[model samples]
Target: MTEQEYFTVHHQLTINAEPLPEGSSLPSYPIFESEIPAPFIVASEFSHLDMLNDSARKELNNSDFKHVINLLDTQNSKLNLLLTFLLSQQDDPTYRTITSAFGASQCTFLSPTSLNDGQYVRIKLFLEHPAAAIYCYASVVECQAQEQGFDITVKYQLLRDADQDLLIKAALNQQQKLLRQRSLDRENNQ
Candidate 1:
C-alpha cells in the first residue's frame, strides 16, 4: 500500500524500543518460523484470536454471526489480560516509550534522544485496549526534533504475517472508535 493508504491512528500505546546491539543486522524478509525469537513466539500465540476473528469476519460478513464475532472478541480480550499478567514479570521498565501514532507498517513515538537513520531496534509493544503484546524488529525511518523531544518513526522489519495482521486490525478498530465518538459528539452538540 502507498504510505498515504497505510492507516495510522493517534493512540498511546506502551512500547519498549531498545536499539539493537552494535553490529546487529535485521533481515529484510520475514523471519523463518524456526528462527523466530522466543518472545515473538509467545506474542504470536496471544495474537492467535485476531486471526480467528478476521477469518470469521470474512466468512460471515453482515450475517447473524456478528454475535459470534463479538463473543470471540470478548474472549480475546480476556486472553490478552491473562497474557499481560503472565508477561508482566518479564517486562522491563527502562525501555518503555509511548507511541504517538502507529499502524501496521510503522510506529512513531517521542523519545528523549534521537535514533540514527537506518538504525535497527527491537520493539515490544503493548496494546492497552486489547491488552495484547507484539514483539518485532524495526528500522529507524525518521527522527525529527520536536519541542519537548524527538519524534522517531520506525518501519517494522521481519514481522510475522500474523503480527502485521493484528496491527492492521487494531488500527481499524481504533479508527472506528474515534469516528463513533466524533459522531456522538456532533449529535450531542446539535
Candidate 2:
C-alpha cells in the first residue's frame, strides 16, 4: 500500500500506563484512538484567508453593498435618486453633481422633513442639463432625525447606472475626505 494509504488506515492509540488499584470498583479502560478523515486532511492543506485584507472576497460576500445604490426614478431628460443613506452630517448630504458620458447633472434633493429612525421619506431628485428637467423618487431606508436635520438612507427604484455611479462615487469620496480630516484632527490634538 502507498504511504498515504497506510497512514489513512493507521489509528494512533494511547493507553493509560498506570494499573488500576486492586479491588477498585472500576471497569478497566483499554485505549483511545483517532483516525484523521480524508476530508479534514484535505481541508487542512488549504490556506486560511485574512478577511480584512481581502477586499474582492469581502465584496463578493457583501452583495447588498452592490445593490445599495439602486435607481429610484427617472423623468424628462434628467434623473433622480433614491440613495441608500440619508445625509448623515450637516456637512455631508449624500448627493452629488457629476460630469459623465451623459454630461453635467446633479442629484438635487431629498424629502421627508425629519430623518428619525423608522421615519420614512420620499425624495425628489432632479437632473439638470443636456436640455433641462428630470425627476426621480426614492423611499427612505434608514434615518436618524437630529436637531439640525435628518440623517437618512434612501433607496432608488429606477435610476440608471451612470447616474448611480456618480452618486456612489460622490458619497464615498466625501466620506473618505471626512474620515481623513477627522484622523488629522485627532493627531493634531494629541
TM-score of each: 0.76, 0.29
lDDT of 1 by residue, 88-160 (tens): 6546688878999999999999888888888998887776545466777888999999998899999987666
lDDT string for model 2 (1-190, tens) is: 0111100111111111121233333222221102222222221221111113245545654676543323211221122121111111111133322211111122212223443333222222222111112122333355556564443444443333433433333344445666798899999999
10 residues in a row with least lDDT, candidate 2? 1-10
Native-structure RMSD, model 2: 28.6
Per lDDT, the best of the predicted structures is 1
RMSD of each: 4.2, 28.6
Off by over 4 Å in 2: 1-135, 140-153
